[model samples]
Target chain A: MASLKDRIGVIKLNQKVAKDIYKMVLQFDDMPDDIKGGQFAHVKLNDKSHILRRPFCICDYDISAKTITLCYAVVGDGTKVLSSYEVGEKLQVMLPLGNGFTPDKNVKKVVLLGGGMGSAVLPAIPTSNPELEYYTYLGFANKEKVVLEEEMAKVSKQLTVATDDGSYGKKGFVTNILAEDMAKLKPDVVFCCGPEVMYKALKKALEPFDVPIIVSLEARMGCGIGACLVCNCKVKRAGEEETYVRVCVEGPVMKLSEVVL
Target chain B: MSNLKVNIAGVEFKNPIITASGTFGFGREYDRFYNIEELGGICTKGLTIKPKLGNPPPRIAESYGGMLNSVGLQNPGVDHYLQKDDLYLAKRDVVVIANVAGSTLDDYIAIAEKINGSKSDMVELNISCPNVKEGGMAFGVLPQSVERVTSAVKKACPNKPIITKLSPNVACIADNAKAAEAGGADAISLINTLSGMAVNYKTRKPILFNNNGGMSGPCVKPVALKMVWDCYNAVKIPIIGLGGITSYTDVLEFMICGARAVQVGTYNFNNPYGARDIAKDLATYVEENNMDINDLVGTLILNK
Candidate 1:
């Protein structure tokens, strides 16, 4: 029942964090308490050409400063326009959107797996709940694409960085390390956000572990809410056939088993 | 507070702001954001005889100042609306406008007849959905076809007021509006999303699953306003204007150009409380200007 709030957030900082990726810090007057890991902010671009607001996962939040950090890559015209924005420029943003990851109090150990920019949501898990033990596996296309190692390390007890081209940290996919270390880590719950292919592979690798896995999905959203019915993915419900649900509302975060992908 | 009320074809609305069909769903989705009753009316999604799964994935594609959608009339059908949705909508304080679409003439008649005596305040015939492969935009393009479909729906739902939603994809939108008015339409609402397509250079294909989709958003406002003005001068029936209406100023512009009421379409996606915000701002504008809401309708000055 949480409604979306449109607030003018000033760009406190907008700088390149890694190759093609720029980290932006938006300072708002009143920050809602419900914003959690995996929830995104629908940011409106100042340029008239980009009509739809682009969705970016919340990378971190500074409660005292009332600021939320977003790490996004310049993939298209919208993101390209966002990158050129100067500090102190006001941008329209709809926030605390979609359901975030549900951190179980009973679960003691957690493993957060992120592929590429999917790592954006990792720090929020630990920052929000300091009591819970956290381990993170971050995957990047190469060494140049890696970002936010220090911030993620501050929240996570242990962090592993992997690259596809053997250019940085461990030379393989993040799932490669998770598959080999799952028995030893003994994580009670696993959360992931990444490309569809990575999700399929991770789901298969964790099939034998008997651990519950949740995934954050990405889609080309029209409304970024349930109204447009554009960001739909087929999901399977208990005792019901597979049906399409909006990723923007039903979740950008959902159980891996519930989703067909 | 200023009086923002307006009557369209005998059905009175609290304000001139109605949520466009397809964009507002059944009013449940946006109810969490704002009170549904605060707006003039709620236009339900286009209903068909049977539940439709709609098009495949990539149903939406972003365009300049707008977006394109190929969602082909996906709904739970009219029976579901009558049994379950009616009570939910009836208990609400707002006017409910049932927007119905069909694949054939019989399909339109069947749906209209079923909704005749229901809780619906009015029925908006959507013969102009461009995404559907069959019977949708085809029935809306030509004046003869528009008249035929509108008259048939009128016969089926004699008790309920009928608004024929016109498409802008045709040669002349004003001609189609005249056709609907000639066919005994109680009112006319237009223009539906302009038929458009977006391309992916790398994929060498269209972005939407249906290849071509209907475009709606801020970019379509001028085109929609011009058409509404043309239709207003052409027909005597009330015209409910829509298409890329995002702000209260746009609402006033449409009214000045001769729209009795305006429906907020793509803006609902941009801001969930868009219509509510516009409704509030409109009242402020009316009070500040010390002008009656009705005085603004059809007050556009023609350049000599």
Candidate 2:
């Protein structure tokens, strides 16, 4: 019912922002104006050696410039290949994919949380939902691995950065700091994106707070749309049987309580 | 003037490009990308009598020049399809092919019977899926089982043509193709994904949760062409060749290797418009060359 096509995007800027993390700015001539936070872009490399397109979260976007920023970590060959490219190279990029984060009518004060590179999914939340108040907390292994803190800070009403070994920002986990802040601020909702282990930590840290927690998920994707069943996430809603929904389609975003994790 | 039409089991197709099963879903997901009627036909995902949830993620892994998928035949039951996608596809001008899979003869027969009266123009019997743990690839590896499953499904769904899909993981794919032909299949499709695994060196565990998956993409083209050529010389029925077909030239290669028509797989994920793009490209090539598209089928001249 939704007719869209894979678009050719020009790489405007590609630069390393942190340790092993690169922020790529892609300029689409016809970028979808409806792009939101937590949605992703499936980018195909110009090389033929890799068949699957690597998916990245829409870290940020500039509507007036028709450009979107993608933040990725060079963890594997696909991302490694992506980091090698420079400006002016054109790639097949399918943007604004998957369902993005949307705050409900009553949601006002929202706490934005990120762990390490998962902070890439945060900045766009404020860009799209600018009306809501955002209190952000970001955690990285150390300062070298930290990214998007400045972009996140500019938009966030208050920004807190943490490192496990205290290389920079506050020492210890961001989840613990968020729990302390949650007690004082009492935000209406908490939105997070991070490694699975961080989610385990956040759930425990925010247990005393009675706010709805939403999260963005990650999966090994094939078709960044729902057509291929490879990118599935297990979802178990209240009183419903455990079922799988495509993370690329049903979500990169879902209610934390409903997720099987 | 060039002709792009192809006839498989007496069913006429406007073009030689069909989107392969499993990769194309029910065609709705792609309808958002392009008009479904632009292609020759559409093959639905592998279906069963009952709904299947399929394997867990990470069910997919990227390899050199291709990708591995262990989707495990996830599909809504035939009943759900008949009530939903069947009606939707029947409304379109394109040919609808329902790919049915089962773990046993009874499972095959039941699903085939259910699809017989549906809107699908043909039934693709998926005996070669390597991901399922049960009766899937079991019936595809041997000539006898291939024949047995083909004939039983044919007996149940006698009204429409049956295309027995062959797997490349078998001992002899040509023999299996012959077995399918002899069992009264009107046509056949090959080769399903090759059985393979992608391992993470750091973890020493397979990337896929299922530990194995069927591999498809441009890298599998050579193997698929050889198998298609072997099956072309072995069987008389029409063959719908597919394995790593991406561009129009790839379609020509498969046709020259004895494919009556070609199906675009994995490439659909590379670009949602991949199937339509290939079809358009092939149509342009045929028109510019001024030759019938069917004239290239089985036309390969091997080196002596």
Candidate 3:
């Protein structure tokens, strides 16, 4: 449930973490039980001029601090407003929207694949419980496009990096690395989030793998609720029939087999 | 204080401000943000006899001043609504207006029968949606069919106030309004979203999956006002004006142009508190000008 009054929560700009990414931490006084990964928040900028709330995915949350971080790219008019705020400046944000990834307890090994901006959210799952053996595979166009390598390295058991231009670790692609290491490491589950092109490539490459796979899709959402069926994904349900369910409600995360890329 | 009450075909409202159909979904979402009882009324989502999955992806596209939507009347069906939706809206204090759509005459009759026995305040017969392929445009575009459907629904739901929502896409809105009136409609709501399309320049393809969608928001204001005025002159019953109403200024413009009341639609996307804001502004405007808000009704002056 969401409302215009609760459309934005008072937030304080904590720090400027990286280029194009600001870490605005909000005080969740009576925060909802769980702010799951892959779920998003709608932040309103400029109480008067802009009426619509802009959507963003949660980067990290600290219960002790009563704060959650939103890492965003400065792309459009809304982001321009978000980028102009200063430290300690009061901001408004709606929280923990959409569905998050379902982490399995029985899994022994985990592989998290992210490309470019998608890397912002990968740290949460690994840092939540450090006992699990986690590996990260990061895909970037070149060295300049890479982000959060050090932060990703801190949580995962091993960090594997790849760039298309061979400006970093592996010269080829993450899919090639995934193909090579599919047997020895034998990850029980694969969680991937990235651009459409990268996800499409992974969709084809990971078809034969026996492990359960989950994909986080990105679509232009209007309401960020079930009412506006704008953010819909074609899903192949059981019985070989296909139908569309809202990405904002049913998921931003679903089983790879259930979705049509 | 200025007699905010309004009764259309016997269904009385505390005020004249209402959350338009498709904009406010059965009052649950909007209720979470504010007290829904403050408003005059609400129109539930367009209902059909059977569950409709709606159109495909890219169902909505952002235009310069507004948006184009082709969300093909997606709903859980009339039976489910009567069985479950009534319980949700029953607790709310505002007048309930059920907007019903259909693919056939029987579909309309079945939904009307459901509304006949329900707690809904008014039955707004929506034969005006331009996005759907079937009964939406078919029943609305032709005056003969409009009269037929309105008559049929009036017969089915004898007790309910029947407000036939008119499409702006038709040749003459005034003639169509008269047709609804002749067919036994107690009231009328004008200017449903205008049919329009947006093209993706780079891809040389339409932005929406349906190729065309209903244009709404600030862009359609003038067109809506004209239709409201046109229909106002031709009909004796109250006209519920709608189309691209974002601000109180727009609401005033509609009232002055001869609308008894108005519905706020696409503006809900940009501002969820749009209806309340408009209500406040309208009250202020009425007070500042020292003119009766009701007197603003049918004040349109047509130049020959």
Tens-digit per-residue lDDT, B77-162, candidate 3: 88888888877787778889999999898999988998899888899999998878988889998899999999999999998999
Lowest lDDT sum, 10 consecutive residues, model 3 chain B, at: B1-10
Clashes of each: 0, 0, 2
RMSD of 3: 3.6
User: Chain A of model 3, TM-score against the native?
Assistant: 0.88
lDDT of 1 by residue, A10-93 (tens): 999999999999999999997877778888888888765676778888888878889999999998878888999999999988
Model 2 stretches with alpha carbons more than 4 Å out: none
DockQ, every prediction: 0.57, 0.86, 0.36
Give lDDT: candidate 1, residue A62.
77
Task: Give one digit per residue, the lDDT tens place, for model 3 in A1-261.
Answer: 554344344566645565565666676665655667677776656543454456677776776777777777776556777777766555555567777876788987889888777776676666455567888898877876677788788878888999888988898788777767878878989888788787778877777778887877777666665556667888998797677888877888788778875
Better of 1 and 3 by DockQ: 1
lDDT of each: 0.89, 0.92, 0.79
- Candidate 1, B1-304: lDDT as tens digits: 5678899999999899999999988998788777899999999999998887788778988888898998888788999999988779999989999999999999999999999978999999998999999998889999999999999999999999999999999999999999999999999999999999999999999999899999999899999999999998999999999988888999999999999999998888777778999999998898898777888788899999
Best of the two (2, 3) by DockQ: 2
Structure candidate 3, residue pairs in collision: A9-A93, B258-B298
